[model samples]
Target chain A: MRFYESKTAPASKGDLTPMIDMTFQLIAFFMLLVNFTDAEQDQRVRLPESILAVPPDEPYEERLTIQLASKDVIIFAGSEFSSLDQLSRALLVEKQILEAREKKVSDTTIIIRADRESKTGKVQEIIQACQTLEFLKFALRGKQAEVRVRSPSN
Target chain B: MRIRHAGREDTTELQMTPMIDIVFQLLVFFVMTFRIALPEGDFSIQMPSASASATLEPQTSPTLQVRLKARADGELTSITLDGTSMSDFTDLQQRIRRIVRDSAGPGESGSDREVEIDCDYHLKYDYVIQAITAISGYVDPETRTPHKLIERIRFAPLQK
Candidate 1:
C-alpha cells in the first residue's frame, strides 16, 4: 500500500536539461556547416561541360586570383587591387624586389576566376595588366560539370 | 526555547542567462555567415552539340590559344592564351601564321595549319561566330578562296 501511494504521487518538476542540450547541439551543427557566399556570385553564367574536369591533385599555392564581377574587377590576393595600372605597377615592384633578393624572379602564376556575366573586356584588362607586369604564367579556373540523371519513369 | 531553534535549508540555482546569450549570438553569427552553394558558370556552359568523335591524341607542339572577350558595347578584347598575352590580335595572327608556315612540312602549306580559340563563356554567340569568320581570312590558303580549313574548334570552359 505504501509503494502504490508513492508511485501515484505527481511529478515534482519538468526536466529541461535535455531540451537545452539538444538545442545547443543543433546550433553547433549549423555553425560548422555554414559557408559564406560573397558578392561575386556567378549565378547567370553557364559553364561548358567536360569529362576531364577533375579537382587539383593537391591544393594549389596561394596565387593571385582576379574576379571579374559585373561592375568592377575584384583582385583578391590577400589584399584587393582595384586599378589595373596600379595592380600592374605593384606586380612589377614585387617582381623587381624578388629578383633583387633571390637574384631570380619567381614565376608567380596568376589565376583568373571571372563570372560568366562579366564583360570579356574586364577579363582582358586583368590579363593585360599581368602581362605588363611580366607575370606570364596564368591559369583560367573552371568548375566541373554535373551529371544529369533522368527519372526512372521517363 | 526549544521551538525557536531551527536549522537552515541549502539552496542552489544555475545561472543560464550568460550561456543562453552566447548560444543565441552564435546562432546569429552562423545565420549571417551561411552561404548557399551555387553552381559555377563554367559548369553550366551550353556547348554546341556535334557528332564528331572525341580525339584524345595530344598535339605535337604547343599552339597559341586565344580567348576573345566581347564587350556589351560591341568591343572585342583579347585575353591571354594559356596565360601569355599577345601584343595585339593582328600581331598575334601574323605571328601564328608565320610560325605555322615556317614549321610546316615541305609539302604542307599555311592552309593545313590550325589554331584553337577559347571564347569567353559570356560572349555573345554572334560575336564568337564573327570572330571565327574574321580569323578565317587570316588563315586562308589562297587569295581567291576565303575558306579556312581550321583543324578543329573546341569549346573550353572559363576557369572560375
Candidate 2:
C-alpha cells in the first residue's frame, strides 16, 4: 500500500490594523471631549434659554448650586427639599460649613438652576433663602441659545 | 563544497490577545462613560439682604420695574415695563434700548441702568428669563454684537 500525504492551507486572518486605527481615533476624539468636572447640571431642571447667556470669563472659586425642579422641589448638594423652610435649614447648615472652613459665605456664589416650568416664585424663594443666609451673589443659570441673526429691516 | 547554513530564519509570534483585550476594554469604558454636556451660562445678580439694602442710601437713577403677569396655568399673560403694558419681550427690549440711549451720559456706558423684575407667583420661570434677556441686553441687528441695556437686575420682594 502507498501512503498519501495530506496538504492543509493555513486559516486566513482578517486585517485588524484598520479596525484598531479607527478605534484609536474614536478613543482620542472621546478623550478630547470628555468633561471630568462636575457640571452641576441636573436632568430634572430644564434651564431657560437666553441668547445673552454667556459663560463667565472665569469660574467662581466657591459656588453652591441649587436646582429648582418642577413642583417646588429644590435639589441641593444631592438632597431634595420640597419646601422653603427645609431648604433654608439646609442653607443655614451650608453657611455654617463655609464659616468653619474660613470661607466667606458672601463670596460663595449661589447658582440657581430653575426649570422652565417651575414657578418664578420658587426661584425668588430660593434666592430669598440664600439672601437670609448671607449669600448675596446669585447666578441664574440658563442654557445658551442658538444664535439667529435678525434682519435690520425687521 | 560542504553546504553550511550560517544562520536560520526565526519566525517570532507576537502575543496580541492581551493587547487587543485591553484596548477593547478601554473603548467600552469610554463609550459607557461618555456624556454630552450642554453649554450653560449664568446671569449674575448681586442682591443684598433686605436689611442690608435698607442701610444703603437711595440711588439717583430711577429703578426700572418690570411686572410679569401669568394665568392660572403658569403661562405669561402680560408684561408691563414701569406700569406700561408691553406687547411682548421684543417691545420691552426696544423701549429699554431707547431709554438707555436717551439717558446715557457722555462718559456713561449704561452699565448703571438697573431693572427690577416683579413676577407673579404662578408665572412660569421661562417668561422671567425672557424678560431678563430683554431687559439685560440685546444683540445689535447689523453687527451681531451684544449691547448692554441694563447690567443690574434684581427681583422684587417675593409676594405670597
Stretches of candidate 2 off by over 4 Å are: A1-6, A151-154, B1-12, B102-108
lDDT of 2 by residue, B35-110 (tens): 8888888998868898888897787789999999989789998999889999999999889988887343333354
Q: What are the root-mean-square deviations of the candidates from the true structure over C-alphas?
A: 14.5, 3.8
Best of the candidates, DockQ? 2
Candidate 1: lDDT of B17? 72
What tier of docking accuracy does candidate 1 attain?
incorrect
A1-154, model 1: which lDDT tens digit per residue? 3454455667777676886797788788887776543344344433232222334455444345555555554645434556777667667766777667663332555655655445554565576566555555555445544434445676
Residue A14 C-alpha lDDT in model 2: 81
Q: What is the TM-score of chain B in candidate 1?
A: 0.43
Give the fraction of native contacts in model 1: 0.16
What fraction of the correct interface contacts does each predicted structure contain? 0.16, 0.80
When only the first chain is scored, the TM-scores of the models are 0.57, 0.85
How many clashes does the backbone of model 2 have? 0
